[model samples]
Target: MSTVNDTKFSFAVFFLTGIPGQKDVHVWISIPFCLMYLISIVGNSVIVFIIKTDPSLHEPMYIFLSILAVTNLSLSISTIPIILGIYLFNSREISLDTCLAQLFSIHFLQCTESSVLLLMAFDRFIVIHDPLRYASVVTLPRIAKMGLVCVLRAVAVVVPLLFLLKRFQYGRANVLSHSCCLHQDVMKMVCSDITVNNIYGLFVKILTMGLDSLLIFLSYVMILKTVMSITSHTESIKAQNTCVSHLFAVIVFYTPEISLSVLHRFGKGSFPLIQILLGYITLLVSPVLNPIVYSMKSKHLHANIIKAFFK
Candidate 1:
């Protein structure tokens, strides 16, 4: 019902979602996110540096792994700093422009991560099914192109959501349960009809989240099939070893995300703190685990991280 020109440019809005909690709650939560952010940056940075610097890992799998690590870095960089500000300053306020921009970047990084994950799955499939062709097929040019595609796909759709949001009237201002900007938070105040927004969001989930997950599942299935066909026990073991770490990282990252979605929809009576913690665990906390999972599973990476820290 609202027009573009009628939408007000919001000054600043508070971000404290849910009923305000005690000082101890803020301290405890902030400390955890701060530490996780530090670890995530250092871990993902070293993974990227190692992948770039080491000639031994110049293969397609490691290249995609490096890309994934970098994407995680992007995710962490955007979410954690704003969250830290909200907690430390006790000021959850964000400008309307800033909020939309943050939403844009968050979705961009998220979609990029999802698409990159799918591409990595395809990379695994190629490595397993046609090891000889992987280096040529997933070359730097192709990888770069795929990266562009992923980022473009992400930005293309999310930018429009802002226009859609702009069509809504801001009946209320500055009431967020969480520390950072989220789609649900922004939409909560819309006095106009938001059924279309919900539909668009659903479509996105089905296409990006659901479709990407299916491709990843299929890629692993093909990979498992190819692995099973290998006769040499030692080579078979070595072949599977390369992909197992990536597989583990994927499971850890997505499982919590899926669970959080289901819970938020189904668990209406859940406590405020519990819901907040789960949401953060799904996005912010999950990223911290990606590099750790990779390093723990990769002997070379584990050794390098340890050596780097010690030195």
Candidate 2:
């Protein structure tokens, strides 16, 4: 047993438990995780490559799509090493600094994805509501600036978490529930009072994920209103068709996350395996699904992918 003062500012390592009570079959579990990571990496990378090499895709919408792919890849890359290590190599011990870095990168990339989706919504809204000014309003330079601001905003919000968590003395068992480090999970191990950490974590969640989800919803509502007002039924259908991919992406991205967060926060007494499974789904599902969804929905992208592969 460790004491507070003894470990104060002296904590240096954390042991990651991949999934509680599933140790015997951790190897079997890695099979699906490895498959998902491979698919996500390849799928998102293909999207980025297609968008970059195709001259016709140099528009705001596809630009945002490329950014989404890049963000998904970042998210997957951020978490994969530790996940593979824990499951395959039995390397569960992560240095304090490494854990902190992983925690920051994972959360930062998640927040950036949310922001990019929000920007995608805005792009759709502009194109649909004011098609005449779409090109002028959402210029390449503006999109570049928007991506920069999204990353900077995530950094601004997540950097404080590092400082806040660092101030605490974690003298308890530093075993994490998931393969990857998360702000909330790591905070639970601190020996000192973590009231501020909890409160601020909730605040940051509401500020980033909560608020972004709300705005994305509102953007779609407005989009629906505009689409319905279109005189031609064919035009309305086309407009709605443009949103199918994004809508699917948003659903996969938020549903698992919201469910996992709720389960962690309030679903006490839930099965540990269920919680661990949900955590993996939340982290892995969207990246693997997003590019596939987009490719299936967007005829142009789909054709481009097929052409690129077959040619």
Candidate 3:
């Protein structure tokens, strides 16, 4: 019953939506969600643990992988609580401040993940393009610095979004389209003109993920060229094989993300259920798959995991 003019940011509460038209089966809907979170948490945790404890795995590549595992773990942790709360307890109401915090954390981690993938691509490129200098050029200290820059870049870009959303006046119709808060979902609920918000959101996406995607593509192109120039066919195949896991990681992370972003911007008339599903996939799939893909592809990691757990 509150008018747009009467609503204050401090007092505003947003309702989150879960599994459209399945309010009766919210508890049932949570089973798969819970499983995905469990896999993401335990899988990524083991990856990080192995990397941290093993001295032989302290190279730049494994260190980067550990950073990525930590990022995936953080991303899953940020959203799982509220999502499970909504499904199990029907606790869908989220305060404006909490919603904004969730939004920031999710997007920041996303940007950080994109950065990590870019770093991985660069790592692969160095390993393939210049194997001897790989250790010299991509040292652990440099990798640590790169990881710090990724976090800083994410912070710089995502923090401004909090301020941008704060200036908007929201109305009583505060139901979010997803079980967790997203910038686009929250921006849609604002009663004020969101042109600036939309523009800035797009700008951030372009500057971070968009740019990262382009760089990753360029890195791969160079990697392929380097591989082809190798006169030894077996060596070329071997070098190309090293990149397969990182390539799969890129596809798993970016495909749903790009689909969701395009759907939000251009698929206004598209089914709401499709958007909701893509939203969940964008948030959950990479976290669940990355650890599996890397473990299966990297013999060293696979052996370590088996030796640690099975032995």
Query: Among these predicted structures, which one has the highest lDDT?
Result: 3
Q: What TM-score do all the candidates reach, one by one?
A: 0.88, 0.94, 0.96
| Residue-by-residue lDDT tens digits, candidate 3, 1-311 | 44545556567889998987798998888999899999999999999999899899998889989999999999999998789999999999998889999999999999999999999999999999999998799987888899999999999999999999887777654888888999988888887788998899999989999999999999999999999899998999899889999999999888889888888888884778989988898889999999999999989999999999987
Residue-wise lDDT of candidate 2 within 127-200, one digit each (tens)? 89999988899999999999999999999999999999777766434787777898878887887788898788
> What lDDT score goes with residue 120 in model 1?
81
Q: What local distance difference test score does each model get?
A: 0.76, 0.87, 0.91
Rank by lDDT, descending? 3, 2, 1
Q: Which consecutive 10 residues in model 2 have the weakest lDDT in total?
A: 1-10
Error in Å for residue 203 of model 3 = 0.7
Clashing pairs in 3: none
Per-model root-mean-square deviation over C-alphas: 2.9, 2.1, 1.9
List the candidate numbers ranked by TM-score, top first: 3, 2, 1
What is the Cα-based lDDT of residue 181 in candidate 1?
66
Tens digit of per-residue lDDT, candidate 1, span 1-311 = 23543544343343555225565577666888789999999989999998887787786677788888998898889888887876676666677778788888777777778888898888878877998886688898888898889888988878778888766556336676566666755766676688888778767767787889898998888888988999999988987988887787778667766665565546654666766766687668657888888888888777876776797
